[model samples]
Target: MAWGAAAILFCVWTLPFAELTGTSVTCTFSEDCVLPCTFKASSDEVIHWNRNNFIVHSYYHDADDLEKQDKHFEGRTSLFKDQIKHGNASLLLQNCNIQDSGQYSCHPSTTQGAQESWVDMKVHAPIRSVNIEKIDEEVICSSQGIFPAPNVSWTTDPPTQSDMLNNSTQTTQDPNGLYSVQSKVSFMGNVSDYAYICSVTSADGMQKWKTSMRQQGGNQLPSWIIVVIVVIGIGIGIGIGIWIGIWIWKKHQTEKNRDGVGNPGDQVPSGAFIAPGHDHVPPDEFGAEYELLTLWVTQKLTMPGTSQDPSAIREFRGPLEPSLRPDTIVSVTGLSQQTSLVQVGKSPC
Candidate 1:
């Protein structure tokens, strides 16, 4: 049976074959796919590929296969030359868009079989936009519509402080077997504006995509305001103390003036006053009648005879009798009991 199969393959290859039978194939998005076909004998046989009623390529020992030709199939389809040598009539399509996805067939002019492949092309959706904004002195970044979400990072220019980057992922797989993710991050708003980057990488890490955003406006006041207020309060307290001290000094000076403490007339002189002859007078002379008379009557009298005239004093009456007139003066020295009293008469001119 193997020999018969080989003879049938040989007869098909040597002679011309009318139509192709069957082939198997598979395809991936934007990646090289395979369309493998087989025959019983094809050591020297060549193969060609056709797409949708169009002959795209023919490779049979550099011979033309006029039975299959299509103008629309040119330049887009080519036989996998390496695989074709191994009887694998595969086609490698470049830059496969979604529209390029379809069924393709392989035809072997020298061999006796038919092969084909079906591909479903998928386009990786890129990140639309990244936005960063300030949320109460903190920076928050959000990205949307990016299939296979990006890695988020927080960085700075001049590098004031260390950067911290965090990411959150949400994945959803579509019916077409494509994955999508979304992520966000929080950072210091002041430093976040320096330089921030979000990078997206494929599963294989071969192709990387990146985007950048900035945080706006960074300035705030802390506890130093409290310290300033405290300092001002102390200054006011000191000012009040100085004003009270000045007022107290003025009040003390006014009280001193009202009390007459420093007035000269209010103080007594420290000395004793004495008359010339009074020094020899007995100590009891201070209590004698003469001192008493001098203090009470002689000091007040303006008589000029008290200094040098005993006659002046004799002329001055010593005492007055009861019968004498109000102005009369009298003397009782060396007097006897007289028989009769004499009365003086007024002198006539």
Candidate 2:
């Protein structure tokens, strides 16, 4: 019957481009993306487009054309002018780069006959970069390969007295050995200093990617404890100079025994004398009245100004006064009981 109606019109024109149906489009980087594709065609049906398979755009018969576009999608493709007038061919791409990301399709052809749809386009590029290091007094953090897979976290500022972290993306080996994937940390060199971060999360999870760094060294101070405090301050200044030389030699031997000196203006010697006394007399001055009063008080103290009387104190004052009635001869010698040399006018009573 005419070769089965030309193989049923060539399987109805390849079954509307193999029954297209898959859509998803996303962009980030001067943003803009749409690519959806729906077509229950009618309104003078006509729409066609493909990507990753060539053919740029079309709207046949009503004439709105484009094709073979791949010079980096020249001027950024387009279509969605009010859903291509109800037949909806969707496409609208602009400022979106990243190789205009994957899959896209559409095929309408009206007169109540063909239809198809599909789309999937994503293109984002804002991932920044950072990495820092130091170990054994730690300070390490990383951001692996960084792409759609990101969601790392770690931050510090004034707060760190022993911190540890690991956002599961761990794998390390640096110092030129190559092997990386990081977001791990450890700090506590007795209080770490500020600025330390590694934030990343963007697939519409609110973009981020910061990698700061800082780590000041510890303070120092021990030189054998300043040489043992200067050798205990020179042994307490030689024990206070031997206790001030034994207190100036016992105050110079108590001022030389109060100057009764071993030297220095010495004198006082004349038989070093000292004594004084006087016996009672008045027995009516008997016995020749005390032998003429001991020869008138020893001839008036030997007449030489009483020996320069320095109050002539002393020389005696006791025992030896007897001469009253025994023929009172009373010729006693130089009496020491208050001066008496005897015999002035005897009363030898």
* Model 2 lowest lDDT segment of ten: 268-277
RMSD of 1: 30.0
- What are the TM-scores, per candidate, against the unseen true structure? 0.29, 0.27
How does each model score on lDDT? 0.45, 0.54
Indicate the TM-score of model 2. Answer: 0.27
Cα lDDT of model 1 overall? Answer: 0.45
**Model 2 lDDT per residue over 278-297, tens place:** 24333434322222212211
Q: lDDT by residue for model 1 over 79-188, one digit each (tens)?
A: 55555555566555654434444556655544454433432333344455566554443445555444443455444443544335544545665544445555455554
For TM-score, the strongest prediction is 1
